[model samples]
Target chain A: MCGIVGLLVKKPELREQLGALMVPMLVEMAARGPESAGMAVFTAALPEGQRKYSLHAPVWDYDWGGFEGEFIKRFGPEAQLGVQGNHAILTCDEPADAVKPWVRGHFPMLHILAAGRVMDIYKDTGHPASVAERYRFGSFSGTHLVGHTRMATESAVTPDRAHPFTAGEDFCLVHNGTISNPYMIRRKLEHRGIVFETDNDTEAACRYLEWRMREGDNLETALGKGFEELDGFYTFLIGTQNKLALVRDAFACKPAVVAETDDYVAIASEFRSLAHLPGVDQAKLFEPMPEEIYSWTV
Target chain B: MDGVNATDRRRVFDLSTARVRDLNQFLHHELPGSGVEQVEVQHPGGRHAIAVGINHPVNVEVKGHGGYYLAGMNKLASVTVHGNVGWGVAENMMSGTVRVKGFASESAGATGHGGTLIIEGDASLRCGISMKGIDIVVGGDIGNYSAFMAQAGHLLVCGDAGHALGDSLYEAVIYVRGRIKSLGADAQEEEMTDADRAKVAELLARAGFGYQPSEFKRVASAKKLYHWNADANQEY
Candidate 1:
């Protein structure tokens, strides 16, 4: 079992308190999933010529200064790295296709969690509260965020196996239920020269939706095809640069409750996760219907 | 606030300060002759299993939304939630009445043996799933797959019923006032007889509704999927 929490603040001023509000929501779900926790936050878009890549070092004390110096020397002075323990955001003026390969060759041990102008990903295998503290998730500021706490039902427990799986750019997805046909979707995507990161079923779903969007389908169209091709029970919460979408399986076996106020839209596996939110007493709360896509724009 | 207070006969519990376990313990602590007969839970904050497993004839009034299993296995207690409720409220209730002033999530009265659960607002999927003798009355629509495999009970939906209503039914009777999206396997809609109208009127009166009984249509088991069809291809 896994717990999923998503929050999208409607007012721009509340963006600064996004993590502060979401920290409690994520922590409350620790009982649902205590093995690992992760979150993907969407900030304001960077300058048009800039792109940021979330890099996770192999060790907590990895020499980010040396890595930053080497990157500046190779990619020119336009490269800047913002360090945060083992994770850092490398912002460069170069394109992703050009910079990604160079980073992989020079720093092969570093894992790239995400790449986009607006999104930053953080995940680790630990208790939700500890993981949030390790990454200082409470200080994060963004327009919206999607978080997950995983229990590792089918996959092995590792940092790389954590959720909020990113596919292409700012797109990320978290799942609660298992997919019965991950290899089938993988094989289908592999035929089209799509590479996979892990054997995790959520990754297959994540990459498939990214592939669909890359092939000129909008998020809605891709999800419609997903409902037909993807065979499993899933309550998927997806994150993008501008929107956060949620959908449940046909049976509605898994639980999901949504609370929307004039200022924000919050979703969780249960109501307690959102009970402490500000103005929640007056918020309109409802359960998402089966097989229905509910998306909120930033 | 005046009637329910810090007294032997009436009590108040603020879940923000007090523990839910404590409240439940009080309900079961020699409840037969205990003078504690009324409870008011304030600031529930969506806690689970509040006021559950009661055997006394007490009155519980929850002021806010409730989480899962608000009052399960209740006997002779009349529980009322002024706000919404989460999943499986009043599940397996033995006797007495449970009422919700707001909406309810999935599996409201699942597997309840005996009781009357009234929802003033809509109820999500599987409202009365596998109900033995409990009667559920919803003031608004019910989601899909409601009353699946219900053995014996009366489910009254004042609003529409979603897809596959009463799939794989046994002996439960469903009364829908609004449209039924679809009926489940071996579950067919029948003409409402005078007895059915009287039942609806009785339940509606119990729920304090003003809707006319003639508006409801009866749905019951067709008994087709009951016996084994050895020669049939089970294509369904």
Candidate 2:
């Protein structure tokens, strides 16, 4: 079993300072999932004249600093890559679809996890500090972030098999627990021409959410739809650039503790993992209700 | 039982010799490592995981209290813990004897594939859930939901039973001797005939309890929930 920690601050003040404050809580939760760790921050960035889209590329345990050079080499110098906590934030000069094929062709393992006004997803193998150091994560700014510490069971320890797996633009997911029906779900998704990048239950979970999102559903509704169809134990904390959502399976087999005060809303697999958060009173802890979907945004 | 130490000639240790925690750990590591046949742990402090995962055919005598999961999954060894055990004592055990001289916690022998778990005291709720061929004999009152979904076994509770006893039991014979609060879904009270009385008497004797066989009540499943009907539109 792995651990997942996610925080969605309703106010901008807490959201801007999330990365610095959440580092210790993520650090304490290393034991629940010791194999790998990752975090993503989704902060809305203002643009002029047109829709400002940020390409949320989940760099699968690749060279973070060299991603800019690698992207330029693959898609020519016109494509620019910015850094955001191990993920390469791409702002293309044109619409991202023309370069999506080239990007996929260049980095076969690279997954276009999310894309929107402020889509950000960063995930990798190893300790959070190691993944943080390779990408200079501490300085990357964002408002809301969802994190993961993975203890791999079904898939290999590659970056593609990591959490926060995405499907198309504006769809990102962080998950815990196993999916018992991946093979059946995979075949259905493949028939629909949805390309799956990894052989992970997490990917299936992402595809389930994405398939629901494609059906004109929002994040909370999509996750609620997932709960109805997906079998097995799971507690998912999913986020787009703006909306944050949480969903647990019917049985509540996997553990998830949620706490909310006047200041912030925090959640992890255990109360011990939330020790570093400000004003985490033990009495405030709560287990996520089974088959319930919770979401909040500013 | 000095005869156990003299003729059995197992490793003997008093409270002054070593702590029960160290003694059990030593016996678990060294008995299997050194091929020692039998061992004893005296004056336990309700600590957990004593004699866990012991594969060899050794006889372990644990004296005093214990916490959770005592003698869990003992493959060939016989562990006689001479005190009350905490929750999930002997949980998921396979092929061994766990005899508790005192009370056992909730879900005692839960999901154990195969074992003979004899408890001299009461057991808590959900005891023997999904039990597969594990024979449980409790000498005292059993809490609610006993023998829940027991696949195959004989659960002999010699005292009063709590509410929701034997809920959703499957292919398991439950013989309770005292008053029952309520029977759970899919489970029904059956007639305690001469044959069931004999079986209960034999099980009580095995657990070192001397009780009249006719004083017990037999509970079993009605087998209604075994098959599913897709088209019948039955709510239950």
Instruction: Name the top TM-score candidate.
Output: 1
DockQ per candidate, 2 decimals: 0.79, 0.04
Which regions of candidate 2 are displaced past 4 Å?
A46-80, A83-87, A106-113, A136-140, B1-166, B169-236
Report the number of the highest-DockQ candidate: 1
lDDT of each residue in B126-145, candidate 1, tens digit only: 99999999999999999999
Q: Given candidate 1, what's the lDDT at residue A90? A: 92
Residue range A2-40, candidate 1, lDDT tens digits: 999999999999999999999999999998899999999
For candidate 2, write residues A31-117 as lDDT tens digits.
667777777777666353222233334544567556567766665676556655535667655455655676677655555655555
My TM-score estimates for the predictions, one after another, are: 0.97, 0.58
TM-score of the B chain in each candidate versus the native B chain: 0.96, 0.85
What is the overall TM-score of model 1 with all chains considered together?
0.97
